[model samples]
Target chain A: MSKLLIEDKEVVIPGQILAEGMDYLPSNGAIREGDNIISTSMGVVSLSGRLIKIIPLTKRYVPQIGDVVVGFVKDLTYSSWFIDIGYSNDAVLSMKDATSDFIERGADLTQYFSHGDYMVAKIANVTKTKAVDITMREPGLKKLYGGKIIEVNPARVPRIIGKQGSMIKIIKDSTGCMITVGQNGIIWLKGPDLKNELIATEAIMRINECSYTQGLTEQTEAFLKERTGGKQHGVHQEA
Target chain B: MAYTKRLDGRKLDELRKVEAKVGVIKTAAGSAMFRMGNTIAYAAVRGPREVFPRSMAKPDTAVLRCYYDMMAFSGAGERVRPGPSRRSKEISMVTAKALEPVLDLTEFPKSGIDVFIELIQTDAGTRCAGICAAALALADAGFSMKDMVCAVAMGVIDGTVVADLDKAEEDYDKGPVADLAMAMLPRSGEVTLMQMDGEASQEHIIEAVELMKKSIKKIYEVQKKALLEKYGGVKDE
Candidate 1:
């Protein structure tokens, strides 16, 4: 007989059995044994019909194809710039995908993108050997200049971004800071001044810390309002 | 003469006081501290990131590397010499083997996960303590693991089989003491590590394994509690 060992949204640890019987299918951070579906990470259980998955509380960012990532240029090759997207290996951002500008071979690549330059790019492909390829040709993807970057737990990136960008939208509207959150958990914040950027950073960090709690959006909205103060034009006043 | 009484007054099947806490080191990717009686072990996990020396990087799966060390003042009898000794290196290897089974690093090819286990205090089972701490640290670091690996040192004192061996029992001169450090995957009841020192008969070995099986479950509970407390309070069930 099929049995569900855990309720939806329950916190589970590695090896904890989530369900029994072949009727249930395990996905994500969970795996299937002979007849039992067990968790393979320390995370919360997310149940959807016959599918059972675990949402890990903490995990290293695994770059996937088509993921928008913030990366720092580590080194420059003749035709490519090695980008560190907080992964095990450096990603390759070649000249063709680097920009729309036409360039000659070995034309001093540093003149375009140099060491220590951060850029918001998209993962174009990942080779079988785990070589990552990122691109900056897409709109809204460019080299971030003079903005502060802060890292958060990659797992919390979704919560920081919120439902359809609601949480981030609230923060942006209040602080008037341009916030770019990368799937790799690296955030770029550039505001009119350092104070606004700092406020945005603190709000993002707070969301990262308390991402597991309920009513996070409301808490964040109140927090941004309090920090930015109600007098600011960006701070929305309730009727 | 039969060794009837435990030196520390614990029952033959009873373990030392177990205490565990996760996220002890804020800087580590995952860190935990586990104390079994007087033996205290702190474990920190780093990476699934780039493998150093590049040549050592695996193309299909991530490498699990462990470093086991005992602090100078942690020993009960004498100060432990700093640096990686032959004993430490062996322990480190066994530790990696014990934890490698549950970890699924296939998703992270060309990466390396390093587990650093340090004994802050020692009373007999330092390696076992380190293993326990490292398992918890790996889980905390959010690595995919099949199950938590629990370890404990079971010893045969004279004719009696005991659960957790303390320093005094290890040093008991009145009887032949045989130390057996074992690690097991609790759910599967699979023994991942079994290293015996001194001497033991077939009957004594069987008895020690039985005691270990029972004690391992208890250790698993403690490890589970440590992880749950850090992530969220224990759910009623």
Candidate 2:
């Protein structure tokens, strides 16, 4: 009799058989091979009910709608700003999406957003031809200034934020730094001091390296306490 | 004629030592260098990134590109010369076809994954080494696939089926030689690549394929062990 050939969280290689006959239907990272279900990639398996899928250990970011990304300004068009969001083609940020204020046509769009500037924006739309449109006329979305940006794995962003913003909030409270996290794996932070900034950066790096490990939040918390020299500044206990 | 032994002193079915050194290139997305006896090849995988030339980008899947080259200093004795030779170009196409069956290109959709394999040293079975190393590098890059492909070559010498053909035994001008290369899914018994050179009888071909099937299981162990060393945390080690 055929059964689920792999256990939950089992690592599998491509073409490795997952099941025989029709006992189970194949899911992502697995395909039907003759009468058997076979894995077509290297990944950690996740079994949900009858559905079995594989999640890769590491992968490049593929754009999805509503993902807030940190992108570099590539060029300025007459009606829009072209941004490179790590894709092959440029994502367009139209002038109308940039500001509420109306400006005369061809009245220096660069005055609002120029080339080489980084911004945290949402992907408003992506077309069949891969044309993308972004918007910044939303709260907490704007042209970033006077801060250093760091890129992390997009998949691990949720872990960095922790459960209900627990991990990032701890880092923010410790350093007393302003930190904005973009879903595209771009982190913006301005710590009180360069040393504080370095500590926060290192903390994120730690998360990126070990996101799969258990007890990551506590480890990150301990890491922050140790890195800040244990001179705990209780910011949330404000009178 | 009673047979003595292989020139390298290995048994008819014995394979050479295999070492898979992964994450060798720091800059490439993923890379590995594999050595089988005297043959060594390095493979680097890049992208699932933007599709180039626009038209080549598939609306429903990703494209797989490969470049297999032998460095001028790879061969023994005199320099083999630089740039893509006719033989290298043919091998490039051959390697690409072999990898196509393994990669689930539809996952990336319009992007491309390029696998570059460089022959660092040669004895025999360089293509086999290259294909094996490329699979590891692709796994290191994290592309979705059915399975990693392991390759090995079989030859009939002195009326015996030998596992891996080294340089001395693969001489083309030599009499009564049958060199067949096979790349397969070790777990499923699916063939992704099979090429035969030199003259051989049908019986020898059938016998050689059986030998290849058994030997690649050993190569599969090596490939899996190498990947686990780097990504052991994801799966149970």
Candidate 3:
């Protein structure tokens, strides 16, 4: 009785059925009923072997473990700092998880992470209610400065990063901009000059506009090359 | 009584005309300009983003705010003022209520999903058209929902049950009679919103509801076509 109602990579909306029975295991965007697997959101259906799932078209950032995010320092608590990751609930950055050095218990929390500073941190844990705990103790994770952060659709972040970092590698080597993309649709770009920064930003927005299309990497690579006058024209296929 | 002809030359139960296009406003996440008969409504949806005014932020779910406006130039005769009035305010709330049941707002908490609908040219039944357009814009913005909502108005005109009444049919003098608007989830046959003014007998009300169900099925096709046209959801070869 188990059957897939949608083709591979077919677009589906909420409440649509993906399967009719228990033969297929449901994943993201799917809810299991007594014998049917139904879609619970608007997304593209993808089947991996026997695993059936749907990739949502629009959604909020659901923090996962080890996700890099751009967060704003919203408030300062007595013992912990609250970070607004642009999602629902604010994430807590305990003073203990702030750094490796032995900082005093209540020794100037703002000086460590102020109320207005922007930081590039990693999600250490995500609770059931979507409350995240971030950490700056990891390498390459710190408070960002002198750079501009732009927002795109978070659902398209995977295409922005490209497969195995191939797409981003082209962007980095081409523009010579220090680019870091967070899973939460925030991109931090720092370049030697504003021209390069603008180029990177425009490129990212273009990718965002057409993220769902095929051959996005080639289009992005070509866009960067033309904008930069082929100075950094080296298109590396996805690794 | 062979009075089957309507003022607009439609049958006793014929829609005027429905034309829609999504993504009209490039800046907004999703937007649409929809016209039913001569009444035109534009809807734009922008967000799952940060909520302004810290007080309105929900701790566990997202907030939906709708604003309905009627431009001064949209009316037929004299100029209408461009601002929010009591009528527009009420229409805004009812329009939001019609489509609210479709969206799963909890998916984005501490944020706001803002929808703006403007009645540029209204000749009656603008709120129903606005709700229909709002549903299209929401889908175009990629927000998932249980089912898309479709709406239509049914009224008794000249002692005849009709669907999608125009301003002429609605202006039957003697203090407007029995104007009913129904917004429903067509597939599941659930009415999420219903507004009635004027008067009708019990039997006529039942007849109007039945007539509304049929028109909704047609309008539902138009709504889905508009979404698929923008998003490329064609499965047929």
Residue B214 error for model 3, in Å?
3.0
Task: For model 3 chain A, give the 10-residue run with minimal summed lDDT.
Answer: A230-239
- DockQ: the better of candidates 1 and 2: 1
In the range A56-125, model 3's lDDT, one tens digit per residue, is 7655567889999998899988788889886666789988788776777668877788987888899999
Candidate 2 colliding pairs, count: 7
Pick the lDDT winner.
Answer: 1
List, residue by residue over A51-156, the lDDT tens digit for candidate 1. 9999988888888999999999999889889999988888999889998888986688998899999999999999887889999988878888887999888889
List runs of model 2 lying over 4 Å from the truth: A21-23, A128-130, A231-239, B1-4, B51-56, B107-109, B172-174, B233-237
Query: CA lDDT of A53 in candidate 1?
Result: 90
- Candidate 1 Cα lDDT to native: 0.90
Give lDDT tens digits, candidate 2, residues A192-230.
789988998999988976777778888988988888976
Decide which is better by lDDT, 1 or 2: 1
Residue A20 miss distance in model 1 (angstroms): 1.7
DockQ, each predicted model: 0.78, 0.48, 0.36
As a whole number from 0 to 100, the lDDT of residue A54 in candidate 3 is 79
| Estimated TM-score for each candidate | 0.96, 0.88, 0.86
Model 3 residue B91 lDDT score? 85
